[model samples]
Target chain A: MSESRNVSIRVPVLARVEGEGALDLVIEQGDIKELRLRIFEPPRFFEKFLEGRHYAEVPDFVARICGICPVAYQVTAAQALETLFEIDIGPWARAMRRVFYCGEWIQSHSLHIHLLAAPDFFGCGNAIELAQIAPEEVRRGLRLQALGNELMELFGARSVHPVGVRVGGFHAAPPPERIHAMREKLAAALPEAEALVRWTAGIALPPDAQEFVSVALRHPVDYAIEHGEIAASDGLLIEAAAYPEHFVEHHEPHSTALFSSYQGRPYLVGPLARLNLNRDRLPDDVQALLAETGFALPSGNVFQSMLARAVEILLALREALRLLADYHAPASPWVDATPRAGVAVGGTEAPRGLLWHRYEIDTDGLVRNARIVPPTAQNQARIEADLRLSLLNFGLDHADDALRLHCEKVIRNYDPCISCATHFLRLNVSR
Target chain B: MSANASVRPRVAVHKFSSCDGCQLAFLNLGEDLLTLASRVDLVHFAEAGPLDADAEVDVAFVEGSVSTPEDLERIQRIRARSRVLVAIGACAVSGGIQGLRNGADSASWVARIYDHPEAIASLEHSTPIATHVAVDFELWGCPVTGTQVLGVVNALLLGVSPRDNADKVCTECKRQGYPCVLVARGIPCMGPVTRAGCGALCPGLGRDCYGCFGPAESANTDALSAQFARLGLDTQAIARRFQSINSQAPMFRQAADKARAAGNE
Candidate 1:
């Protein structure tokens, strides 16, 4: 009778990452039947509301989409606007943009590595429990997170929705003294960031690797963050403007998020995807650091996502230090953005993954239309795919408590921007 | 894991429809977060842990705004369990950025982005908690600063009335000795009407204030709107100023309505 019992599970995962959504899973006689990572995140209808908004308001408008990755939205929207106007932000402003992005990568990734993901790995309930178990480690993680916040603070006043980001460039530049001051602070946190890499490298995550299709942006000279070509592990290269031509979004009835597919197959994005596509672009020290951990690139284990985030934190620190060394005020805070009617695309790597933005501006520079593909929405299919595969491997017929914890572990690995995905999930199990 | 007799106020944080930024204010506290934990029993924080949301608590810090049926029910449930339901950030106090949708056609807003409008379950408007249930007090900011969050938390723990300065951003800007971005640089700013506590950060950076903190204690919004016109901002542009973060607040909403009326004229 026990063997014949049907399995039904619901884990109401509140936007543990700052959004709201829930999960529904059904199992029929050991075979997983239905799994819907439903994101009923109250439809803010961001893209719809963006219509009729001015180009100058793009940064402010999009930044409101995700508080965690506001820089990603601001920069992506700004770059798209710049593309339409056919204006260069100047070399100084361009380099400065990378520095600003580095802050986001550091802060956002560190938050995940320490607060969100580590608890699962440590077999604890949350970061606080993990803190009790490993006080020093938790302290280091918090300090690293604070440094990331400080990095953003140096550029954008505060780490949340920075007002400094404008269309063509920043609203203003930080003084050299402030940059030097932040550089000194980052220097203090640098060693701990490397330790974060090594520590996550040693975490005895279960050896679960599978075939994966990874996607990220590729730049000519630097580790891609601010702007790049859309590159995939499948050897697909599409101009940023031609993103819609290759990728398609499908609205699943079960989930509010639009599931994106590459040629109608599940694919991966975020830190792991970025590391796979742009490993060579990483600095020599970072490359050596990755080698030192014996963690080969192009990994399929989603858990190494934690490792990938840690490595990105180190890279962000190094780049920030270099950029801040000789910081100066730009001749102008922004280029003259005389918006003309045109359609353009801009893609940047948010801490979680690729942030794609496209805008059609009218003659008056008001947004005629906008399409934003946040990384979490792109990774929704992948998250469910991983859940389906992992649950089956973990034996879905197991007790509800054991199965639910494992499922939450797998979900946290992606750091799903649940706020960005129509997001909380509550767990309910029924036969 | 500790018992209820721990002599600490059981505090829980809840979210509605806004970004997790305001709640992050607590975690972003770094070492201070631990200090805060020592002072208060953090029973349920979705972003922080997997605790029970229905757990009875002495003080409940609520973020975000009511934008869906679930949010409506959830706020009611949280209010029942919480002794003091304190609203945090603009989302709780003024319906946040999503509140901009209040005057617009909700159906069109959904139809604009999603192909399947029927799938959306959002309420017609994103509204602050005060509209649905009684709120003990509100801390206003797009994302309230760590200082404000900690101040409120301490006040709750000590049973004191939370102190919000109720000053305008301009007062802080003046204290910081930064020349007015609007006066000196001709940049249209909402500093005159926006609240303090964000440290007048925008004006300090030579940028205009976008009113992340909602309206000041007693804002002269009409006078400021006229000042914006004198600075050469068109009615539409001036309306956009009051239309970002706190557009649903009574004062900001009135100012935006006036500018929009003028724009139509």
Candidate 2:
């Protein structure tokens, strides 16, 4: 009979991240062990609560699912219901959607970069501490983040959980002057954002590489922020419509979020995956910024995700500028969307990663069924896998430091938005 | 509040059950953030970076609702650590949109999302931070605006009383010279009763206010209810409109209660 050894780890509070979560790893006999990334955040039951609510109420209801990427929820929910109603918002409306989405990416990615990711590079507990050491860098990062929020406010009417988004389009398009004002800010922000990319790329990254099943949207003409077909590094190509058929979510005992597997395998998404898969789609300036930072495609060092986010920030700024330059106010801010009985799915690349919404609507346009799969939920399994692989190499005696850094790295890789993944909020860790 | 105080005030942002939007709002201050950071000690902000070794806080900006026992205890600790604790956003101020479940069974809500309900432990309802600890101020919104957040920070820095108006959204609408969507299109709106911080956003976009900003100070519920009734909306629909988004807020809750009571009568 073989003797067994027990290994356990508990993180009292997970730091430098949004929402709340804890990790518990139980190792027996040194070979491997039980790892639980317990998502004990209380269930708000957004899908259940969404039942019988009018289709128009979806943007507000779903937007509550994530504070970080409320626009993502609003866009995906609006898109799903709009599809059910067969409402085709014109190019101008679509451009507005792109603009709104760009705000979310800027806000969310910048949060990840300065507040969440940079602390690891500087050996600080959080961004606030990093500010003490390098105040200018932190300030530049915050300004860039604010610029994103400005866009959200200009287009969506509020930075978080905007009320202007509707099924067909915005409640009202911004005035030309407001768009121009935002353009001026983006112009100022572009250089700072590019500098951030260069600065972040120079950070010493962890050398471990994994053959990632990177997943992201691929648009033919530009870097895919709002609209595109879904593509993965493993040669799998599918339209957004085929998402349900290609990927499935499984309920795991350790998490409230459903772990998603693409064709029965764990996959990676978000800025790193997007940058690697769609580098060709990025603008020349953004591509050049990537080159200047020495960032290359298919780089599996998860730490470079911060750099990838910076690269995307550059792309978002350029895209925002381009959209502003060609801005044309829609004849009507929104089209009348009459809900019909149907089941529909809407998929979009949220700042964090792929956000999906599926809904069944009745003839009266009330939601009969609602299922939202956020990027964090999809990344849960991969996060645990990273923790398991990373920590297994490091022994239990150094568990606290190893586990903390390991957990932070794993979380940074996914850029998990726990708020979007759970309906209610709480973070619990039980070993 | 001394202008020439020797030590700069320490500000820390905390999270419970939230979207991290309120903290993001602080980050949204941009270049102003550098000035703010230099002016004060940013002690602990998890969404921005790492947690401080010490838990002491001078002014704590707390986001999210108290949705668990741990949150309840953490709020108490934060209050003990801070001289001023400001509850930011709908979640922290009024239990947020998730508070829609306050009237429902939390166990059932859990079962709806999870396969094994027994594995999870949670409170029956999501409640605001003030329910657990004394809050010096509350910023209302589904997600509070960056400008308002900066205003609070600036007020605290300047040692001046933070002036947050509790006017109705209608005031902003009238100021902006926008047409009334509810009166013109018969769309149900909460603008007359909703708080004013959002600058009449939905109405500006040609839509009725959905009241993400909670209710105005001393809003006339009876007037709005009668007006909604005059608009030919049913009692149940009126109740739902009042109960949504800001349902847990006092003024909105009172209005919803009045509507329900009126229906019962």
Candidate 3:
């Protein structure tokens, strides 16, 4: 392979991540000339469709934005509306909400680790091949994933697009028996999740450390999941209300999805970023497990994101167990929310990363406008940035197939949810 | 033990313009997913790491609606290669929630969202997979569950025709011994006319059915709307109830139109 020869790689459809996307990369004179993570997942116009819908419907409506993390959208939307209505969801609703969100983190992280990203390191084409090679590990991953769905179902009725969330609180609370059963299941899965942390930490990850800013939610008393103020590795902290002033989303020619940049630069989100920013918030045992695995926090290596996801799964399990320890059905699940005219903004840590939402409502409770900034879209710029640096480091002269695989691995490592990313609205679109 | 891979039914899960919830039904199968992979040849499921989109398969589970120009061409190619094309979830069956744009001004909606609307390759109307290509079977839900998807797959693998349950959600509620939210709590429920599959999920959760499963066979949506009106729902509210999730389904479409027209009168 001569360095002078130009190479072009086009992946028509990127497999294994959420929604439709493709990659186009070009190397000129052995220097990376162009790289575009072309997210062709068609715009769903969710923001536009949200207009005129009542406040109560926002949770279910937004849940459709991303199936992999529906609870993220539900919780974020509910929080936004609750803030505007000035309603207190109370301690019971608050605790249960965290448990519900834990279910999402566990299932989503386990799925990504086992089925999506793990096979890449082992030279397997898919999880099926990986299962043939390591059946027990794969089975354990599926069991943990199923347990997450079960936890979600215990409160949500069904996990995929759960119907339990309402504006003020939940539509119904799981009885004490169901809660007890789930607590036991969560307890049983903790060991399995801990094992997952060890297993991912041992994988042969490519040592291609790069410079990037990490961003996630930061709760004062907890490792933010359901609620938090937005924080960055660069030491910037702000509420969801100040998000638009700091973060900007713009459309690129190659992608239908919007790319988000903070302070005019690409920053990282998701499990690795969360772990990087909030490592001290972890419970002692979970922290001890990470320490035992010899996985350092604030790791610059992007490939260790698999390990990061596994660690989060262990943390989520612990969080769910602690929350469900003392379960009592609330006499009323939701308090009545009155219609009001105001703007609402909320930020929460979705399984992937920070999911922020804003809504404006009329006195009749009809939504006048809506905007959602999903984690994947925020990471789009960062993904392309990583691709350029990673491929250059891995050598552009490698075979096209090798480059494509590496590109897919890099993108999948982010666990980019293209569906959630493509729903952005550009306020100044030229007619 | 499963049969030889070469002879087993080949399966591929495809996505278009959806949240990936329906395709996730395969992954959500949890342990059964591994069993399914062993029983079938999963040559092209992108979420699980296989990316042979053009591979010929015995059964193709298509999720999401045809919302883009590329989507239109891709669905046709899939239909050609697949021996049995199954459209899964509300997106594939009746255009899902994204199909809400169908009744509204789609171009204006695009202009409102994207800076370069011309750069966005989107069809004006978000449509079901059936609208673009021949579909063998349709599974309805905002997101079709793992059990529903697996039942269809198992039936196809066994060479038996899968059952299509057209009964309404009310029937499922009756069988489950769950009280009706509409009659008991004065909530405007869509169970009387919405299809059964969720096993009356929302009703069991003490909430009104929002019709994620689309319309039942010969559903009297007009009567349901009348009932909703009597329950103190405004015309717009009644219309919105039918126009959600499965807005593009024929019965729901007509019901929504009628509700809006009645309001105008």
Candidate 4:
């Protein structure tokens, strides 16, 4: 056992994630020598592409960033421009936006749980193999995912890169009849969402407690899906406008994504982070369901992220049902907002985590400058930090395949949207 | 046909430089997605956890555009390994929204977005996969619908050539009985020149189409641009309508150039 072993491991392409990346790890003398989560997803230069475009085009334009969470980009951009132009958007549209976002959460989380992450815990190569063993669970996950997509299409024309959101509000309202049909579907899925929580909680998750700061948007009276002030587990609370003062994204040589740090420290931002900071904000029934699982709030173990995603699905389903029970078509789906010259900033909770957007609009209604900080970019440093700790905990002396699988498991737990992150790995290990 | 062959036809899904939306069209198929595994050997779809990039296959459905040197090399390798390569979405057919960077100073944009632009590696212009490799077919859309994708797969399974439609979006819009936004509301719509695939989604939603599907066959871009001008759009706006997601398409590129030159007049 005292003998030293040297090996080089290269995961040329990290699979089952949102976008393309590879992982590189180097071990020497049975000790960790070098570990780098190389994110080579080609930079699309989205912020630069936003310059000189009209404010009206941003919602649809930004939706191209990530297919998995297109609603996040659209909603955050609309919120920024609407906040800048001083448009109210009214209560009806406000409540509908939350329901729209809930659809994204349900679909994205369900896709991750069944298609991406669940297979890892079961020692299956892919969901297809997992399906052979657990057909009912896989089918249930797909049903929930389809239902979520349907909710999105109710307002959006389609789920992937949906095109319904505009600056002031939506382009068109769903007729009351359509809303009625959707309400029935949401009510019917309640029992299924509850079962998802119980099923995920019952899965055996690995045990590794590590220290990290959790960052998310926190609303005063709600779970804060679409709007909120920026809050962190370290007691840092600030208006979305003040986010730049605390958070600084720096360029790294290996990644196209800018590695974001909160006060020069790697922090967490995702389902686990959101639940950790806002567990009390859940409704009474959801709180009771979560309590039944016996899973403690503010969990430090990253493997518990699966449970958090499942719990949030139930929370989103209930939230959507409550908002849509009294649905009515508005006289005007959107209002015209006169363009103004000023800096616009807004933050919203994407399924992955907090997504922030900033824009400078001119009196001519053109975007003068733009910047977007997606969740995966914020979690880059945190993911790298976790890889080092989790690998060492799992024992570096293990086989390369075992170590590589462990690395992918940890990364996928964050549901890193590399497609969104170029705005956010190949694994190579040398010993 | 491989349908009757002893070996199941192996299929691979490849990614390049764009959003994951087009490939997501496959996963978003939901129930059909599970059944798809039973029909073919999905040997190399990275997002779904199978990662054999070099696996030779009967069909390869590629998403995104070739935007970097790495993308340039990978697409060729995919074309070599694939028997029938189908380019899906605007990015693979034209150059996607990132193609907006084409004909501009890409280095400047990189500098604007990053602190040290020297570290970033990308091509001067994002180009379609067809620019580098021969594409057997093209499914044009910002993101192709699940039905369109399933249709192609089913055709391949039946040992027949998949069909391509080159009709304009206006045809689909008229067929759906949606009021014409251009004539009735004076909204500048791209339906007259944009390809038909999205089933007139924007027009059905009471908004104008933005030409996400690129140019249809023999699209009259000059007429569309002239119509846009009559709708009170300026030369700049007229140019931008053709220059959005499908800016890299030859017809749209020419329209954008002509409109921009007219602004000088």
Which candidate gets the maximum TM-score versus the true structure?
3
The DockQ values of the predictions, listed in order, are 0.52, 0.50, 0.82, 0.58
lDDT of 1 at A211: 79
Estimated TM-score for each candidate: 0.96, 0.90, 0.98, 0.97
For model 2, state the Cα shift of residue B221 in Å: 2.0
Candidate 1 C-alpha lDDT tens digits along A238-284 = 88888876777777766677888888888899999999999999999
User: Which window of ten consecutive residues has the lowest lDDT sum in model 1 chain B?
Assistant: B108-117
lDDT of model 2 at position A127:
67
Off by over 4 Å in 3: A428-431
Q: Model 2, residue B31: displacement in angstroms?
A: 3.1
Chain B global fold similarity (TM-score) for predicted model 4 against the true chain B: 0.96
lDDT of 3 at A148: 86
Error of 4 at A427 (Å): 30
Chain A TM-score per model, please list them: 0.95, 0.93, 0.98, 0.97
Better DockQ candidate (2, 3): 3
Q: Better model by lDDT, 1 or 2? A: 1
**DockQ score, prediction 1:** 0.52
Instruction: Give the CAPRI rating of model 1.
Output: medium
CA lDDT, candidate 1, residue B107: 72
Which digits, one per residue and each the tens of the lDDT, describe model 3 over residues A1-431?
99887888998888888887899998898788889999888889999889999888889899999898999999999989999999999999999999999999989988998988998888998888899998889999999889888889988988888999999899999989888878888888888988888888889877798998999999898998998899999999999899888888888878988888988999999999999999999998888888899888888878889999999999999999998887889989999999789999999999989998889899999999998889999999999999988887888888888989999999999999998899877655243
Q: Which scores higher on TM-score, 3 or 4?
A: 3
In model 2, where do residues sit more than 4 Å from their true spots? A1-9, A25-34, A132-135, A288-293, A392-403, A424-431, B1-6, B50-56, B147-162, B257-265
